[model samples]
Target: MDKHSIEKEFTALIQQYRNVIWKVCYIYAKDRENLNDLYQEAIINLWKGFPKFRKESKPSTWIYRIALNSCITFFRRFSRHPQTLRLTESWDFAYEENVFSSQIQELYALIHCLGNIERALILLWLEEKSYAEIAIITGLSQTNVATKLCRIKEKLKKMSNQ
Candidate 1:
């Protein structure tokens, strides 16, 4: 594709999948600044990887892979910046009506308790991705995805009740 066509297609794709990117970033990053930084990095990675997209999977699946990978890379780089260290804060559930919001925040916290990349895997699963799709995106088996998701749910429930 020429530059203009590529840009157009990229814009369309971004419009379609922006929420997926945002949710992935929000799940991993604590604050707005880090969320924006992670979002930009994911966008850059998505643009770079666009040409390699073979259309074998849904576009959302492709974008999710890129977004999650970018978040992992960002975490690694951010961890190395000693001066940038900040204490992680737990989500508050003071507003009872915001149960969904509180659940999501609590879910993010629970995911963080998992092993490094496992957190990303569970986030993708909670996004309601099918096991086959997740396996295709993460290069894991459907059975593996199912098993991990089961474990993740139990962990989240246990944490939320605490």
Candidate 2:
């Protein structure tokens, strides 16, 4: 395809999958500012890879892979740096307000405590992606995905009870 076509398709794809991107980013974001930064990083990576994306996988599957990988990498990079400047005014209220309910907010808080891979796995599960699709995006075997998800659920259950 031509440059214009590629850009058009990419723009459409991003628009269509915007929620997926935000959900993935929100899972890894420490706060509002970090969420925006993670989103931008994911968009940049998606644009970079769009031109070369093979059609072997479904669009959503490809998006999940790219967005999840981008957020995970962003988290690792920022964790290593650990020198981000914070604003005096807080964005926590806005973040909480975006969530549908208190239970979801609490669930998110528990999810935040999970390790990066666990968070990613749970995010995919919450999105109702099939085990096969999760395996594809995560590069894990189907059996591995099932086992990890079971462990993650138990871990979350334990955390919630406490």
Candidate 3:
């Protein structure tokens, strides 16, 4: 494709998958400022990988792989550069309607309580991806995803009761 065509295609793809990027960033980052940084990182990674998209997998799957990888890399870098840490204040969700059932907001708050990147992985797995798909995206086995999810659920339940 020509430069203009490539840019147009990239823009369309970004618009289509923007929600996935934002949601993943929100899950990984503690607050809005970090969320924005993570979101930008994810987008940059997506753009870099666009040319290599072979269509060997579903577009959503490909997008998820890029997003999760970006989050992982961001966390690693952030860990090394602690000076980049920012305030962790909550932001209002743009949509008022429930997206993942009525308890989503509470669930999200509970997720924040977990306070780790692993929670982001578990949340993505629980987003109804098949175990195999989760494994593929996360570079883990189906059994591993299942195991982690079980532990995460127990943690959330325990947190909820507190």
State every prediction's TM-score relative to the real structure: 0.81, 0.90, 0.81
The TM-score, computed over Cα atoms with residue i paired to residue i, of candidate 3 is 0.81
Candidate 1: tens digits of C-alpha lDDT, residues 38-114: 88999999999999998888899899889988988887877753222112455432222234555555556666566
**Weakest 10 consecutive residues, lDDT, candidate 1?**
80-89
Residue range with the least summed lDDT across 10 consecutive positions in model 3: 81-90
- Candidate closest to the true structure, highest TM-score: 2
lDDT score, residue 50, model 3? Answer: 93
Which residues of candidate 2, in runs, are more than 4 Å off? 81-99
Q: Of the candidates numbered 2 and 3, which has the greater TM-score value?
A: 2
Candidate 3 local lDDT, 1-162, one digit each (tens): 899998999899889878877777767775657777888999999989999999898888888888878877887877653322212323454322335543666676667556444665676766788888888887888888889888888887887776
Please name the candidate that would achieve the greatest lDDT relative to the true structure: 2
Instruction: List the candidate 1 regions with Cα displacement exceeding 4 Å.
Output: 80-100
Ranking by TM-score: 2, 1, 3
Candidate 3 deviant stretches above 4 angstroms: 80-103, 115-117
Q: For residues 1-162, what per-residue lDDT tens digits would candidate 2 score against the true structure?
A: 899999999999999999899889888888888888988999999999998898898999999999999988987776964332122323373443464566677787778778889999999999999999999999999999999999999999998886
